[model samples]
Target: MSDEHSPLIPASYDIVWSIVTVLIIALTIVALVTLARSARRLTATQALIWTVVVLFIPFLGPAAWLTIGRGGVPVERT
Candidate 1:
Protein backbone atom coordinates (compact mmCIF):
# COMPACT_ATOMS: atom_id res chain seq x y z
CA MET A 1 0.00 0.00 0.00
CA SER A 2 0.95 3.70 -0.34
CA ASP A 3 1.15 3.83 3.45
CA GLU A 4 4.38 1.87 3.35
CA HIS A 5 6.13 4.57 1.25
CA SER A 6 4.22 7.64 2.55
CA PRO A 7 6.78 10.14 3.79
CA LEU A 8 5.29 13.35 5.17
CA ILE A 9 7.82 13.17 8.00
CA PRO A 10 11.23 11.65 8.61
CA ALA A 11 13.73 11.56 11.50
CA SER A 12 16.58 12.89 9.35
CA TYR A 13 14.52 15.84 8.10
CA ASP A 14 13.76 17.03 11.62
CA ILE A 15 17.36 16.68 12.70
CA VAL A 16 18.69 18.60 9.71
CA TRP A 17 16.15 21.41 10.12
CA SER A 18 16.98 21.78 13.81
CA ILE A 19 20.69 21.97 13.09
CA VAL A 20 20.21 24.58 10.34
CA THR A 21 18.05 26.77 12.58
CA VAL A 22 20.56 26.62 15.41
CA LEU A 23 23.44 27.54 13.08
CA ILE A 24 21.50 30.49 11.69
CA ILE A 25 20.71 31.80 15.14
CA ALA A 26 24.33 31.45 16.20
CA LEU A 27 25.60 33.28 13.11
CA THR A 28 23.13 36.12 13.56
CA ILE A 29 24.10 36.57 17.18
CA VAL A 30 27.79 36.59 16.36
CA ALA A 31 27.30 39.09 13.54
CA LEU A 32 25.21 41.47 15.64
CA VAL A 33 27.56 41.34 18.59
CA THR A 34 30.68 41.88 16.50
CA LEU A 35 29.01 44.76 14.70
CA ALA A 36 27.94 46.34 17.97
CA ARG A 37 31.46 46.31 19.35
CA SER A 38 32.98 47.55 16.12
CA ALA A 39 30.48 50.41 15.94
CA ARG A 40 31.90 51.87 19.13
CA ARG A 41 35.39 52.02 17.67
CA LEU A 42 34.60 53.10 14.12
CA THR A 43 33.23 56.36 12.76
CA ALA A 44 29.46 56.57 12.26
CA THR A 45 29.70 56.39 8.50
CA GLN A 46 32.21 53.57 8.53
CA ALA A 47 30.06 51.54 10.89
CA LEU A 48 26.96 52.03 8.79
CA ILE A 49 28.74 51.09 5.58
CA TRP A 50 30.27 47.97 7.08
CA THR A 51 26.98 46.89 8.61
CA VAL A 52 25.14 47.14 5.30
CA VAL A 53 27.96 45.50 3.38
CA VAL A 54 28.16 42.62 5.82
CA LEU A 55 24.43 41.88 5.83
CA PHE A 56 23.89 42.02 2.08
CA ILE A 57 26.99 40.25 0.72
CA PRO A 58 26.65 36.46 0.57
CA PHE A 59 28.90 33.76 2.06
CA LEU A 60 32.43 34.89 2.96
CA GLY A 61 31.85 38.61 2.51
CA PRO A 62 30.62 39.19 6.06
CA ALA A 63 32.96 36.83 7.85
CA ALA A 64 35.99 37.83 5.83
CA TRP A 65 35.49 41.53 6.41
CA LEU A 66 34.81 41.10 10.11
CA THR A 67 37.79 38.86 10.75
CA ILE A 68 40.51 40.55 8.71
CA GLY A 69 39.20 44.00 7.86
CA ARG A 70 38.15 44.99 11.34
CA GLY A 71 40.90 43.38 13.33
CA GLY A 72 42.92 46.58 13.70
CA VAL A 73 45.78 47.29 16.04
CA PRO A 74 44.83 49.08 19.27
CA VAL A 75 45.90 52.60 20.08
CA GLU A 76 46.43 54.20 23.47
CA ARG A 77 44.54 57.32 24.52
CA THR A 78 46.41 60.31 25.87
Candidate 2:
Protein backbone atom coordinates (compact mmCIF):
# COMPACT_ATOMS: atom_id res chain seq x y z
CA MET A 1 0.00 0.00 0.00
CA SER A 2 1.35 3.43 -1.03
CA ASP A 3 0.64 6.77 0.63
CA GLU A 4 -1.12 9.46 -1.39
CA HIS A 5 1.88 11.75 -1.48
CA SER A 6 4.97 10.31 0.13
CA PRO A 7 7.36 12.28 -2.09
CA LEU A 8 7.65 9.19 -4.33
CA ILE A 9 11.27 9.35 -5.41
CA PRO A 10 13.13 6.09 -5.98
CA ALA A 11 16.79 5.50 -5.19
CA SER A 12 17.55 4.54 -8.79
CA TYR A 13 16.04 7.79 -10.00
CA ASP A 14 18.17 9.74 -7.60
CA ILE A 15 21.30 8.00 -8.79
CA VAL A 16 20.48 8.61 -12.44
CA TRP A 17 19.69 12.26 -11.85
CA SER A 18 22.89 12.73 -9.90
CA ILE A 19 24.92 11.23 -12.72
CA VAL A 20 23.18 13.41 -15.30
CA THR A 21 23.78 16.55 -13.22
CA VAL A 22 27.46 15.74 -12.87
CA LEU A 23 27.81 15.11 -16.61
CA ILE A 24 26.21 18.44 -17.44
CA ILE A 25 28.54 20.30 -15.09
CA ALA A 26 31.57 18.56 -16.54
CA LEU A 27 30.49 19.23 -20.11
CA THR A 28 29.95 22.91 -19.37
CA ILE A 29 33.42 23.22 -17.92
CA VAL A 30 34.99 21.52 -20.91
CA ALA A 31 33.02 23.71 -23.31
CA LEU A 32 34.17 26.90 -21.60
CA VAL A 33 37.80 25.81 -21.66
CA THR A 34 37.58 24.85 -25.34
CA LEU A 35 35.92 28.11 -26.21
CA ALA A 36 38.54 30.17 -24.40
CA ARG A 37 41.46 28.34 -25.96
CA SER A 38 40.03 28.37 -29.47
CA ALA A 39 39.04 32.02 -29.19
CA ARG A 40 42.64 32.95 -28.54
CA ARG A 41 43.68 31.47 -31.89
CA LEU A 42 40.91 33.10 -33.92
CA THR A 43 40.59 36.61 -35.25
CA ALA A 44 38.42 39.15 -33.42
CA THR A 45 35.45 38.66 -35.72
CA GLN A 46 35.73 34.89 -35.71
CA ALA A 47 36.12 34.79 -31.97
CA LEU A 48 33.03 36.91 -31.52
CA ILE A 49 31.05 34.62 -33.79
CA TRP A 50 32.21 31.51 -31.96
CA THR A 51 31.49 33.12 -28.61
CA VAL A 52 27.92 33.87 -29.64
CA VAL A 53 27.50 30.35 -30.99
CA VAL A 54 28.77 28.72 -27.80
CA LEU A 55 26.72 31.03 -25.58
CA PHE A 56 23.43 30.73 -27.43
CA ILE A 57 23.64 27.16 -28.70
CA PRO A 58 25.44 25.47 -25.80
CA PHE A 59 26.41 21.80 -26.43
CA LEU A 60 26.37 21.70 -30.19
CA GLY A 61 28.22 25.02 -30.52
CA PRO A 62 31.24 23.94 -28.52
CA ALA A 63 31.37 20.53 -30.15
CA ALA A 64 31.08 22.11 -33.57
CA TRP A 65 33.96 24.46 -32.92
CA LEU A 66 36.21 21.69 -31.70
CA THR A 67 35.31 19.26 -34.48
CA ILE A 68 34.41 21.33 -37.52
CA GLY A 69 35.16 25.02 -37.03
CA ARG A 70 38.72 24.40 -35.94
CA GLY A 71 39.53 23.20 -39.50
CA GLY A 72 39.80 19.52 -38.50
CA VAL A 73 43.40 19.19 -39.54
CA PRO A 74 46.74 18.56 -37.95
CA VAL A 75 49.39 21.25 -38.30
CA GLU A 76 52.66 20.30 -39.94
CA ARG A 77 55.92 20.35 -38.01
CA THR A 78 59.04 21.86 -39.48
Candidate 3:
Protein backbone atom coordinates (compact mmCIF):
# COMPACT_ATOMS: atom_id res chain seq x y z
CA MET A 1 0.00 0.00 0.00
CA SER A 2 2.28 2.75 -1.29
CA ASP A 3 1.38 6.22 -2.59
CA GLU A 4 2.98 5.50 -5.97
CA HIS A 5 1.83 2.47 -7.90
CA SER A 6 4.46 -0.18 -8.58
CA PRO A 7 3.79 -2.77 -11.28
CA LEU A 8 3.84 -6.28 -9.94
CA ILE A 9 5.86 -8.94 -11.77
CA PRO A 10 5.10 -12.50 -10.81
CA ALA A 11 8.12 -14.75 -10.28
CA SER A 12 6.52 -17.52 -12.31
CA TYR A 13 5.83 -15.29 -15.32
CA ASP A 14 8.96 -16.45 -17.14
CA ILE A 15 8.12 -20.08 -16.50
CA VAL A 16 4.58 -19.60 -17.80
CA TRP A 17 5.84 -17.79 -20.88
CA SER A 18 8.42 -20.48 -21.56
CA ILE A 19 5.82 -23.21 -21.30
CA VAL A 20 3.45 -21.39 -23.66
CA THR A 21 6.27 -20.80 -26.16
CA VAL A 22 7.16 -24.48 -26.11
CA LEU A 23 3.55 -25.43 -26.73
CA ILE A 24 3.27 -23.07 -29.69
CA ILE A 25 6.44 -24.51 -31.17
CA ALA A 26 5.18 -28.04 -30.57
CA LEU A 27 1.87 -27.25 -32.25
CA THR A 28 3.73 -25.79 -35.21
CA ILE A 29 5.76 -28.96 -35.38
CA VAL A 30 2.63 -31.09 -35.16
CA ALA A 31 1.15 -29.20 -38.08
CA LEU A 32 4.35 -29.85 -40.03
CA VAL A 33 4.34 -33.56 -39.14
CA THR A 34 0.68 -33.92 -40.03
CA LEU A 35 1.42 -32.61 -43.48
CA ALA A 36 4.60 -34.68 -43.67
CA ARG A 37 3.05 -37.98 -42.56
CA SER A 38 0.41 -37.72 -45.28
CA ALA A 39 3.21 -37.68 -47.81
CA ARG A 40 1.65 -40.26 -50.12
CA ARG A 41 -0.94 -37.65 -51.05
CA LEU A 42 1.03 -34.48 -50.26
CA THR A 43 4.09 -34.07 -52.46
CA ALA A 44 7.41 -33.71 -50.62
CA THR A 45 7.78 -30.12 -51.81
CA GLN A 46 4.18 -29.30 -51.00
CA ALA A 47 4.48 -30.66 -47.48
CA LEU A 48 7.74 -28.82 -46.87
CA ILE A 49 6.32 -25.57 -48.16
CA TRP A 50 3.14 -25.83 -46.14
CA THR A 51 5.15 -26.67 -43.06
CA VAL A 52 7.20 -23.50 -43.46
CA VAL A 53 4.06 -21.45 -44.09
CA VAL A 54 2.38 -22.76 -40.96
CA LEU A 55 5.41 -22.11 -38.78
CA PHE A 56 6.14 -18.62 -40.09
CA ILE A 57 2.72 -16.97 -39.82
CA PRO A 58 1.46 -18.02 -36.40
CA PHE A 59 -2.38 -18.15 -36.25
CA LEU A 60 -2.78 -17.35 -39.93
CA GLY A 61 -0.70 -20.36 -40.86
CA PRO A 62 -2.65 -22.90 -38.81
CA ALA A 63 -5.98 -21.35 -39.70
CA ALA A 64 -5.22 -21.49 -43.39
CA TRP A 65 -4.10 -25.09 -43.15
CA LEU A 66 -7.09 -26.14 -41.07
CA THR A 67 -9.49 -24.51 -43.49
CA ILE A 68 -7.81 -25.60 -46.73
CA GLY A 69 -6.01 -28.78 -45.78
CA ARG A 70 -9.04 -30.49 -44.25
CA GLY A 71 -11.01 -30.00 -47.45
CA GLY A 72 -8.19 -31.40 -49.55
CA VAL A 73 -7.99 -34.64 -47.59
CA PRO A 74 -9.81 -37.44 -49.33
CA VAL A 75 -12.78 -38.87 -47.51
CA GLU A 76 -14.59 -42.03 -48.65
CA ARG A 77 -18.28 -41.26 -48.47
CA THR A 78 -20.75 -43.94 -49.35
Candidate 4:
Protein backbone atom coordinates (compact mmCIF):
# COMPACT_ATOMS: atom_id res chain seq x y z
CA MET A 1 0.00 0.00 0.00
CA SER A 2 1.07 3.60 -0.63
CA ASP A 3 1.85 5.91 2.30
CA GLU A 4 -0.34 8.98 2.96
CA HIS A 5 1.10 12.45 3.51
CA SER A 6 0.32 14.54 6.60
CA PRO A 7 -1.29 17.99 6.51
CA LEU A 8 0.99 20.91 5.59
CA ILE A 9 -0.24 23.29 8.31
CA PRO A 10 -0.31 22.48 12.01
CA ALA A 11 -3.35 23.19 14.17
CA SER A 12 -1.62 25.89 16.26
CA TYR A 13 -0.45 27.78 13.19
CA ASP A 14 -3.95 27.70 11.77
CA ILE A 15 -5.30 29.43 14.89
CA VAL A 16 -2.61 32.09 14.72
CA TRP A 17 -3.32 32.78 11.05
CA SER A 18 -7.04 33.11 11.76
CA ILE A 19 -6.35 35.68 14.48
CA VAL A 20 -4.09 37.67 12.18
CA THR A 21 -6.71 37.69 9.45
CA VAL A 22 -9.38 38.95 11.86
CA LEU A 23 -7.11 41.73 13.15
CA ILE A 24 -6.35 42.96 9.63
CA ILE A 25 -10.04 43.03 8.77
CA ALA A 26 -10.87 44.88 12.00
CA LEU A 27 -8.14 47.49 11.40
CA THR A 28 -9.38 48.12 7.89
CA ILE A 29 -12.93 48.64 9.09
CA VAL A 30 -11.85 51.06 11.79
CA ALA A 31 -9.78 53.09 9.35
CA LEU A 32 -12.64 53.37 6.86
CA VAL A 33 -15.14 54.36 9.56
CA THR A 34 -12.82 57.00 11.00
CA LEU A 35 -12.17 58.43 7.57
CA ALA A 36 -15.88 58.62 6.85
CA ARG A 37 -16.67 60.33 10.16
CA SER A 38 -13.99 63.02 10.00
CA ALA A 39 -15.52 66.50 10.25
CA ARG A 40 -14.34 68.52 7.22
CA ARG A 41 -10.81 67.34 7.79
CA LEU A 42 -10.70 65.74 4.33
CA THR A 43 -12.31 66.96 1.12
CA ALA A 44 -14.46 64.68 -1.01
CA THR A 45 -11.71 63.88 -3.49
CA GLN A 46 -9.18 63.33 -0.74
CA ALA A 47 -11.55 61.04 1.09
CA LEU A 48 -12.20 59.05 -2.05
CA ILE A 49 -8.49 58.63 -2.69
CA TRP A 50 -7.94 57.57 0.90
CA THR A 51 -10.81 55.12 0.67
CA VAL A 52 -9.21 53.50 -2.33
CA VAL A 53 -5.85 53.37 -0.62
CA VAL A 54 -7.26 51.86 2.53
CA LEU A 55 -9.21 49.23 0.62
CA PHE A 56 -6.58 48.27 -1.92
CA ILE A 57 -3.38 48.38 0.17
CA PRO A 58 -4.88 46.59 3.17
CA PHE A 59 -2.43 46.67 6.13
CA LEU A 60 -0.19 49.56 5.14
CA GLY A 61 -3.05 51.71 3.82
CA PRO A 62 -4.97 51.72 7.08
CA ALA A 63 -1.85 52.09 9.18
CA ALA A 64 -0.68 55.09 7.18
CA TRP A 65 -4.06 56.77 7.36
CA LEU A 66 -4.34 56.32 11.13
CA THR A 67 -0.81 57.55 11.69
CA ILE A 68 0.53 59.97 9.07
CA GLY A 69 -2.63 60.86 7.14
CA ARG A 70 -4.62 62.02 10.17
CA GLY A 71 -1.73 63.87 11.78
CA GLY A 72 -2.74 67.36 10.67
CA VAL A 73 -6.37 67.09 11.75
CA PRO A 74 -7.56 68.40 15.10
CA VAL A 75 -9.71 66.22 17.32
CA GLU A 76 -13.05 67.52 18.64
CA ARG A 77 -14.50 66.27 21.91
CA THR A 78 -18.19 66.81 22.64
Model 3, span 42-74: residue lDDT tens: 777877777778988876686667678746867
Residue 15 accuracy (lDDT) in model 4: 88
Q: Which candidate is the best by lDDT?
A: 4
lDDT (CA) per prediction: 0.66, 0.69, 0.72, 0.85
TM-score of each: 0.56, 0.55, 0.59, 0.79
Summarize candidate 1's per-residue lDDT along 22-70 as a digit string, tens digits: 8755665576577777676778887787777666764354675557646
Question: What order do candidates take by TM-score, descending?
Answer: 4, 3, 1, 2
Give the alpha carbon lDDT tens digit for every residue of 41-61 in model 4: 777888888889999997999
What's the lDDT of the predicted structure labeled candidate 1?
Answer: 0.66
- CA lDDT for candidate 2: 0.69
Q: Give the least accurate 10-residue stretch of model 2, judged by summed lDDT.
A: 69-78
lDDT value for candidate 4? 0.85
lDDT, residue 30, candidate 4: 96
Candidate 4, residue 61: Cα displacement in angstroms equals 0.6
After the best TM-score superposition of candidate 3, give how far the Cα of residue 30 lies from its true spot, in angstroms: 1.1
